[model samples]
Target: MTELQLTLEEKIGQMLICGFDGLTPNDHIQQLIEKHHIGGVIYFSRNYANVKQIADLSYELQQMNAASSQVPLFVSIDQEGGMVARIDNDEVTLVPGNMSIGASRDDELAYEAAVICAKELRQMGINVNFAPSLDINNNPKNPVIGVRSYGENADLVSELGIATIEGYQSSDLAATAKHFPGHGDTAVDSHYGLASVPHNQARLMKLELAPFIRAIQAGVDMIMTAHVMFPAFEPEQIPATLSRRVLHDLLRVQLAYEGIIITDCLEMHAISKEFGVAEGAVKAVEGGADIVLVSHTLQEQVAAIEALIGAVRSGRIQEEQIDVSVKRILALKHKRHVGEYEQLTGSVAEQFGTAERKDLIRQLTEKSITLVKDEQQLPLNLSEPTLVIWPEVRHHTQVDEPIVQAYTLGPALAELGANVKEFRIATHPTEEDIQSAIQLAAQYKQVVVVTYNAVSELHEGQVEIVRQIAARNDVALVVASTRNPYDLNQFSEVKTYLCCYENRPMTMSALAKVLTGQLKAQGKLPVTLSPEYSFGMAAQ
Candidate 1:
């Protein structure tokens, strides 16, 4: 151990990982490693340029730490495909979300997805995969967990979670089952601010905790604490990150999870709004969080170490506690054998994201298309100019876009026929836009309303518009439920509702094949919608 390692302050440094701003920030990160001895780094889109660049970066980062001390650093990232990937986007194959995979209901496919995810991550020197989102999306109004979750059902989620975990670890990457004690029922996002849950032990044990329990039973190597506050469980002042009741009493003791427990980012609004990163880091370790995440503070990374060191010396915190986390972390590193990347074996990228597994996404999209409520004209008159209502893919400037290819919906639609004219309906349809679609319906023999929800937002008016147009005598509705499938109430009139679950490359192709009569739609809805439709309802 280096001089820094001699102090509890320095070991705590190994607990607070951070994200940086380039593919080649390895040298600056190395300087920090030598200075503070941080536990690890959480990679985002910014730190990566391509596969080769990231692999080289990971090598240099590991080399610097080896030069300083033999204590291994946790190299981690969110490789949860669909929308959650953070490496070299263009260089990496963009996989669909968990719900899409769950829609297929194929365990092998889920396993393969993880295998590919792990292969790429492993090739680039990532040892910890902060993924296999075990959240049971029991709430339809849940904004963040909609597409990210496997489905609404607990058993389904547990099954897929196990498969995903297995896939990730198959290549020797440490799999972390996240947002512990269930982030499923909460309505708000922990990213923007704190979210609360008020359920008791009975309800939590029955529903919300199912996937988490199952995931833990499935051999999850790590568990990440949710930033959300569940006041009912422990009414005092602790969020899950700071709550010893949840982390120690429940997850550690009750669930019997002996591995490391990593807290979600301490820099998130939930943690930052109250405690500084240093204070949060100190409390989190006391709360039994083996690894406290400070993903955005490279400069302030040393502060947490300094605080913990002071606290340990003052008897406010103990050195043994720090050693506990350090031991668990070292075990994780040893399991990874951090310096032995070259010796790590099993599946590689070629085994992952194959043409066959890629085909499953298309197959699931076609199967998951839920035809909610449709008028008598089942297959449509087939002569109308189909109105394609696509919610604009809003561009967020805060996070860098992965170099992955720009996504589009044209080629799939074009396969059906050249005559299928497409119109861009604002996802949240406007009254005037409805009138425009209505007017176009008059000129065309059939009016097909194709709809898509961009993110968690419910394009409220579009469904009402579909309901109105579908009531027409000559018109037929073809509602394509793209993205999150929750907004099914928007199209009561459409004869066919398709839950494509996502807008990935294969999903579009599957939809195109189904619409053009190349393949019959076979997917059933994976989760329960409103009172309007039952769960697993798929069209013929």
Candidate 2:
């Protein structure tokens, strides 16, 4: 079906990609598809259970949409791997994230990982993957997007980002390079509130925008807008999701990107709490976003479509403008073969999570384990009693799920027959928790302190606890960051440090191997840990 054939309501519906409750297709989702004619659906951990279930659900959603809308639904997921994967199960290949790939200093690994992830996603009927985050994580204080981004260097990020983009496209999956205009320099999380980048056009172009420009030139399938505000681009304090100057004037006109432009979910506090999602959706479309994502609410999804239709009818946004977006959406769907109604048959599930794939993923993880520094503590004696100070599992950001945080280094070490005694502390340790942890460390011959993105600004308790524990002269101490490597900057006095860049089971297993001397720490630092530690600094 062409753009002209779609009604104004349908056109507006195509601009929205909504999320609803339940693992299966519920009434709200069906209404969005059959009745409202939405173009696509976004999958989250709430919508996923396991490999086979999600695969079947994707197929069912496409089949249902095909019967009503004529345009097949874009089954989309944020399977960027590492910390942000939506469908993480034992039956699927758990690819390491972009930063891990960057640490390996091999663009081929980035390509290979993306190819494996894309092939697995395709088997599950997921045509579009919001991946290859090109944001440069230059600021260590960034709460979100720490390990999701490739690295601090523009050239490295550009090389790896393009490599990943090509990998996904080669497997016929629509790859999206996300959080455009950059979201890597902020201290705030957009899920909680608005964040802004205060750089001028020259600095942004040199640092933040470099990877995106390379991605556009590489012919990336889509670009996802950031909710971050840039005072340099738009004078108003609104985020890029609602700024015409940022999205249309800068990205579309100045950059000349013709691919699909998707907004980061309007339901996020950055947009929803400030401007309201329904109004934000209309403004997103006006700002040159082809797809206005509302990831978590049914009422907001319906209201957004209604508001967009009202905007067109009232001439606040012209019908021709809506047509332009619809045309691009249709063109990309046809180009990617997502518009075709087809069902995957013959147990594609068997191809996923194979021993060979697991081996490859394990190798990548082992290669990414970075030994930042070591003070004659190359490998711990498993014969001696070791105390593992583990943080109580908590959401790192609103984007994180508890399931993703379930894996830990303590269990992985115990499984290896290490004499490990685990002590769980709060994510942000209390004064009593810190004192208790300190006394517990005194009882052991060796101590391993694991941190989860404990930047000094927010997680001062975790930082202080590690600092005081490392000061003990009687016990051997080794500090490791299981999430972001930036924790090293908080406790520079610690003589030994390592970073795994994620808390995934694979990463935990790899860190265990490194500690036991089963594998060497061969990864380089993807980002600058501090003034004392530069990019590519690693100790063998």
Candidate 3:
């Protein structure tokens, strides 16, 4: 497909990847394809049900697009695994998160995990994965991108990111190294408001921008722009997604990257609330973005495409510029054979979530679960009644999906045949909730507290609860951070601490085995906990 052959509307559509609310094709999605001529479709947790349902939907959408447009849709999903995963069902295989992979210090495991994810996505007809988040998670207070990142160290993140990119692309899936420049050193979540990394170019090169530079060298297929602002490079207060200095000058010219540059969803608050999605879309393309993603709202999708067309017609954006982006997009689709449509035979593959994949997940989890410290509480006494205080199931951040059936510490402990009494606390526990939990701990001989991102001030109530519980001399206390490892920084008094990286089912199960003496804690810390407990500190 040549750029000269496409009409203005068609070219505009080719740069868009929109999302609609449905398990199957609806009028809104059809209109985006037939009327708007969108280039791709993005899948969230809402759009998925099971393997067969989503697979069928992918096949049908491809057929639908084939009838009207010559270009094939880039069916993409944020299957970054762990907390940010969109596809989670009984039929699909799940792997340990990036932080966990980093903890294991095994680049082979990282490669294998991505290979598994790519194969599953390919079977479902998903050609692109917004994965291998190369963000260096240096800020513990960051509401988003905590465990989703590889680690705090630039070299570890770079090596593992390169492994993931190779794994995905080797399987014929386009791998996207995301949140360009970096999104690691921020406190604010871009989903809610504008966040900035205030470091100079020298500091960014040393830490934040290290992984992306390595990724470009490794020939990453796509680089997704961050909604984060970099004051050192980009003079304007606008995000890197709309800053030509950041995307074009820094990423394209300086780094010499020549791949597809896709923007993170324009509907995110950093773009949507600050600049309207329509205007943001226009500015994104002008800033050298190859694809502008509007993941929600039909109105925004339509308006953004219309705004792009208007910009072209009014000479605000030159037609020649549009040609460059479209050419890159088409060249990638052709290389990946993304336009080829093939229907599933009304059945899923036997290898989707086989025991082999399940065992890999188990091995990865066993290798990743870290015992940050253990003074005397090595193994729990299963003979006596144990109290498990866990945070109630909920979304930890705006990026995390609302979990339908979250695997908790209580159930994991129970599966190991422990005499367990479970107590649920609000994610952000209140004074009343804390008081009740403290009082409840008096009844059990052993107390285990599972925290979810307690390092963040939003969940500071958890730290207070753990401190009060630890002060009690009667019950032996244990603290485990299920999401972020930085929780140990908050309550250093707790002698027994474990870092699970994420609260996924595999992590919870592996943690259960570690607590019961069935598995050993061999995983090291991927990120620095504190001055005393630095990176690689773990009690084996």
Q: Which candidate is the best by TM-score?
A: 3
Off by over 4 Å in 2: 340-349, 404-407, 415-417, 430-432, 456-458
Tell me the TM-score of model 2: 0.96
Winning candidate number (lDDT): 3
lDDT of 1: 0.71
The alpha-carbon lDDT assigned to residue 515 of candidate 2 equals 92
User: Per-residue lDDT tens digits of candidate 2, residues 1-540?
Assistant: 899999998898888898887889889999999988999999988888877778788888988887887887888889888878888878789898888888888887778888888888888888999998999998887878989988999999999899899999998899999899999999888988999999999999999999999999999989999999999999998999899999999999999999999999998989999999999998998888999899888889999999999999999999998899999999988888885444556664568888888887887788889999999986888998999988765544566676524557888898888999888887777889889988888888799998977875556778987888877887789999977888887888898899888878899999999998888899999998777788999985
Per-candidate TM-scores read: 0.88, 0.96, 0.97
- By TM-score, the candidates rank as 3, 2, 1
Error of 1 at 235 (Å): 1.5
Query: For residues 1-540, what per-residue lDDT tens digits would candidate 1 score against the true structure?
Result: 432355654676777677776778655576668887787888887777666667777877877777776777778998777656675244465566778777777777678767867776787788898988888787787766777788888888889899999888878899999888888788877766778888888888887788888877877889999987777677876689988888898888998888889988887777788777788878888888888787766655667667778888889887777787777777777777766764223443453345665565445345544455544445533354555544443444222132223343445565556356655565555678777766766665555455555223446656666676767766555666666786665444355666777656666667666665667666656778776676676644
- Candidate lDDT (C-alpha), each: 0.71, 0.87, 0.89
- For candidate 2, the C-alpha RMSD (Å) to the true structure equals 1.9
Q: CA RMSD for every model? A: 3.7, 1.9, 1.5
CA lDDT of 422 in candidate 1? 57
What is the C-alpha local distance difference test score of candidate 2? Answer: 0.87
What's the C-alpha lDDT at position 297 in model 3? 97
**Residue 177 miss distance in model 2 (angstroms):** 0.9
User: Model 1: residues >4 Å from true position, as ranges?
Assistant: 1-9, 26-28, 87-90, 342-385, 397-407, 416-474
